[model samples]
Structures are given as structure tokens and as C-alpha cells.
Target: MFKNIAKDEMNLQDKPMSRFVNFNEWIFEIKTIRAIRVSDYGQPYSAMANINIHGESAFVDSLMTKSEQEFARIDAKVISEFLRQLGIEQVQFERFKNNQPRLHSVSLASEPHKEHKAKLVSVG
Candidate 1:
């Protein structure tokens, strides 16, 4: 049932996909499944929603350095909302044997944040 639902939601094509560069601490390659067309030029552009953060150490350090619980709560809320806007239902943090942080698979769902309507954008 879930497989059918997922298949219905996504459109697969054999054509080559466009890649976008995210220049930050780390390099990210974002690919979009749909093509966006401009009304003025009628040119079609693919969307790539990739983001690159410098590294996990920087993120962990920021979280650890927060002195107040309120600050930490605010930070977590921001991150959660950001992820929710990206169609992520839940986020889990994991660490490897070397203590390197990694993100696990994200389960896609409808937007959970109700306060911000401006952040919602149609990707498909």
C-alpha cells in the first residue's frame, strides 16, 4: 500500500536531471523531480533543493555551546520547522564509531508547522 502511494506521488523520468551546487562548509548537490517554467521567458528550469552545511562538528558545537535551555529549545524548534518545510516528517541524529554525526533517512509527510504559511512552496 505504501509503495503504491509513493509511486503515485513521484514521477520518474529517464532523462538526465539537473544538479545545483550549494557552496557552504560542505558541498551539496540538489536535484528536483519537477521542472519549473518561467512566465516571462517560457524557459523551463529544474529546481534543486540541496543545502550544504560546513560540517557536523560545527552544528554539534553550536548545540553544545548553548548555555540556556530556552536557547536550545528555540534552536531545535527552528531546525524542526526548517526540516518540516522541506517535507521531512521526522529527523533523527546518529553518530558513528568516530563520533561523526550523520542524518538518517527522512520520512516525507505533509508540513507540520502551522504558524508559517510563507514557507510552504510547491515542489512538484
Candidate 2:
């Protein structure tokens, strides 16, 4: 499962598969799957799902990050099994797995900022 983080969103290919599954008493509609490259070495794959609980959305990923070390190996069978356990059909999961995981680079332009001088005040 994915945890809330402040990071860039992965870019995926067009026409990704969409499926619905029930999890934790909420209906989740998985919208897209993307193979993310957060670091310069490894690739992180994630599923973007929309929860029907008050129209909330969240991401789900199978990742192991500890002490600045991260690794993940997600394949079709694994994804299929996960979705299968989540009440999604085999066919739908297979389709989701078969969908090409397009990896793209995401970049943001840096905005220039002015330097401000700070005054030191002693608190007694």
C-alpha cells in the first residue's frame, strides 16, 4: 500500500486500464499504473486509485524503503494476485498488468527568489 508523500507524480502512457475493487469497506477505482523512477538507480511502480469514500483519491504501491534504501520488483503475476485479493477479476487484473508501463521524466521549472536579510534579536 502507498503512503502519503510529497513527491512528483509519475507520467504514464495513454489509455490506461481502469478497474474497480472493494478494499477496507471502500470502493476503489484504479485509474492508472505507472513505473516511477524516483531515484537514479531504481524504478518504483504504483497504482493510482480513486476511493468512493467521500470522493477521495490515493496511490497504492508495493515498495520497501528503509534507511534511504529503496527497492521493489513488481510484475504481472504479483499485480494480478494483489488485485485478485482485492476482489478484482482475473481478467481485469491481467489487463492491468498487460498494460504497458510507460516511464517518463517529470521536471519542474525553478523560480528565482530574492535574498532577504535577517536581523538577530536577543530574547531575555
TM-score of 1: 0.27
Q: Which residue runs does candidate 1 get wrong by more than 4 Å?
A: 1-62, 66-71, 93-124
In TM-score terms, candidate 2 sits at 0.21
Candidate 1, residue 106: how far the Cα is off, in Å: 11
- Residue 86 in model 2: shift from native, Å? 2.6
Question: What TM-score do all the candidates reach, one by one?
Answer: 0.27, 0.21
Off by over 4 Å in 2: 1-28, 35-74, 92-124
Where does candidate 1 clash, by residue pair?
25-54
**Candidate 1, residue 71: lDDT:** 26
In candidate 2, what are the lDDT values of residues 1-124, reduced to their tens digit? 2233221233222222335545565665544444333444355523322212111122333322343542333333343333333333322211122455432211111211122222222323
Candidate No. with top TM-score: 1
